[model samples]
Target: MTAPILEIRNLSKAFGPIQALNNVSLIIPRASLTIIAGPDGSGKSTLLKCLLGLVRADAGQIYLKGQLTDKNFEQIRSISAYMSERFSLYPDLTVEENLDFYACIQMVPKDRKDDLKHRLLERTGLESFRFRLAANLSGGLKQKLALATALLSSPEILFLDEPTPGIDPTSRLEFFRLLEELKKEGRTIILTTPYLDEAEKGDEIVFFHRGKIIKQGSLSDLKNQFPLLVFSFEPETNIFEAYTELSKLVGPENLILRGRQLKIFVPEGEELIWRGKLLRLKREEPRLEDIYFYFERRSEMMELGHDQ
Candidate 1:
């Protein structure tokens, strides 16, 4: 059997009184896209930083290529590239210049630099904007440029943190397409995003909440493991009125408002009770967001029970 490309074992970290990571362990197979998804302060960034050796973990071990050694740091540094939430490319330099500067800093051999630069520029669709100043590029274009710079070194593992936050929908779609292309090139990509739809694109997803992984699996696995039945309704009356009535009947924990529609999750065999209370009700497949919230709420309830 082939070994995983990257592995984390019992990893933990803390900040003063706050524990940032709690016994987190995960495995990344070769040439796959893995997404660590959660909201802010869920330790997504901290986990990525630990893998890059930029943030030291208070406990646990990291293995690369199935080997755990004291040289793990050196190995990871040499073969990995990280694009943080704020990748600091020189604002004054042109796109091409920024790539060249990073290539030089990474000590890419002078003989191979030009060919690598050409390929990265073409691959990232930055060829036309090569001479454009970094500060003047659009948000998506700047992100593409940052990715181009990160790729200059030709690292085997790529880590990204919230790479698409606040970008327009069109740009986000384009960026994900680029990532799919990179994955096809046989590089292992690990990234974090709060966007559930974006996270759905990955081969495997790890859902983090409050310093812990609540669940990890492919989309199908997640849906199968979800413990509730979901139903969507198109109300005949005012949407807000429908929501209020449904919230009272099923409690707000089971209800979600999506534009003019309302969705509710109820236990098995309880669907009829809520279906009778709304119009145009239909059983629907659970989305990644629904699955995430289910696990998150379950974890909270479990914790609360233990406290009591």
Candidate 2:
């Protein structure tokens, strides 16, 4: 509210006949952990690149600190750290070597270098692997080193592209632990992930679909906007047949199959008969995945997506 740290205005981009991004606008409050979620090829990467000026927008404006200038582009680049889904890390270089080289290039001072390196490695849990060549590390450890390198200069804003996609779940948990530390240090973090369940972790979230923002708000705010409640069912017979039959009563558009069970949104007053037919039905807590899928289906039914 007090002048967003990052402001995007009417951003648009296209790749030939396919529009990679439509007119999109968003504001990232200072020191917020913002998560961007979308299906594959929905323009998540393009949006990040456009915001960072790595990819120019066809028509839009990006303002940082209330200042906009094409000439000082590199200066804006300096205040941010980026790690792509396929991050660039030298396979042959030792983890320590990569950190030292990155620090030197970023002009991190010698007097503070050791302290900074130790802190990052400790935070990312890469301290023991520092002497190991990056190529020799496991997928999860390599990701930690790549993230550590990005943190070398302690940029005020961090941009990541699914940095934990292939890493083990434990490693992904550790990665977010590092981000939690950054949050305490007052760093603004924004990243994109296809995993819908992770959306609940952010202070604010923007949902990207078909190159536009369908929803953006704090998790509680977004969840409150939906007028649906979830009911879970466990079948005594075939789960598939039960789901198939229940799909008719509840409408396939509103059901999400999870394992042998399903989470359904039962419209108010349209529930008695449906509840009577179910072998076992219970009210359940609504997870972020439920919230995301509900809107995605709603958007499809509306035949329109929300953006700027």
Per-residue alpha-carbon lDDT of candidate 2 for residues 1-308, written as tens digits (9 for 90 to 100): 36777888888999898888999999888888999998889899998888877888898887887766443467667888898887678889999998999899989999999999999888787888889998999988988888888899889999988777878888888778888888788899898999886767789989988788877888888777767768887666787887888789777767888897878887655553554652345777777778778777777766643432
For model 2, which pairs clash? none
**Candidate 1 TM-score over all chains jointly:** 0.90
In model 1, the worst 10-residue window by lDDT is: 271-280
The C-alpha stretches of model 1 lying farther than 4 A from their native spots are 69-72, 233-253, 257-261, 271-281
Q: Which candidate is the best by lDDT?
A: 1
lDDT of all the models against the reference?
A: 0.88, 0.82
Runs off by more than 4 Å, candidate 2: 69-72, 234-250, 272-281, 304-308
Candidate 1 residue lDDT tens string, 59-160:
998889988834358788899888989766788999989998999999999999999999988888899999999999989888999898898888899998
Estimate the TM-score of every prediction.
Answer: 0.90, 0.88
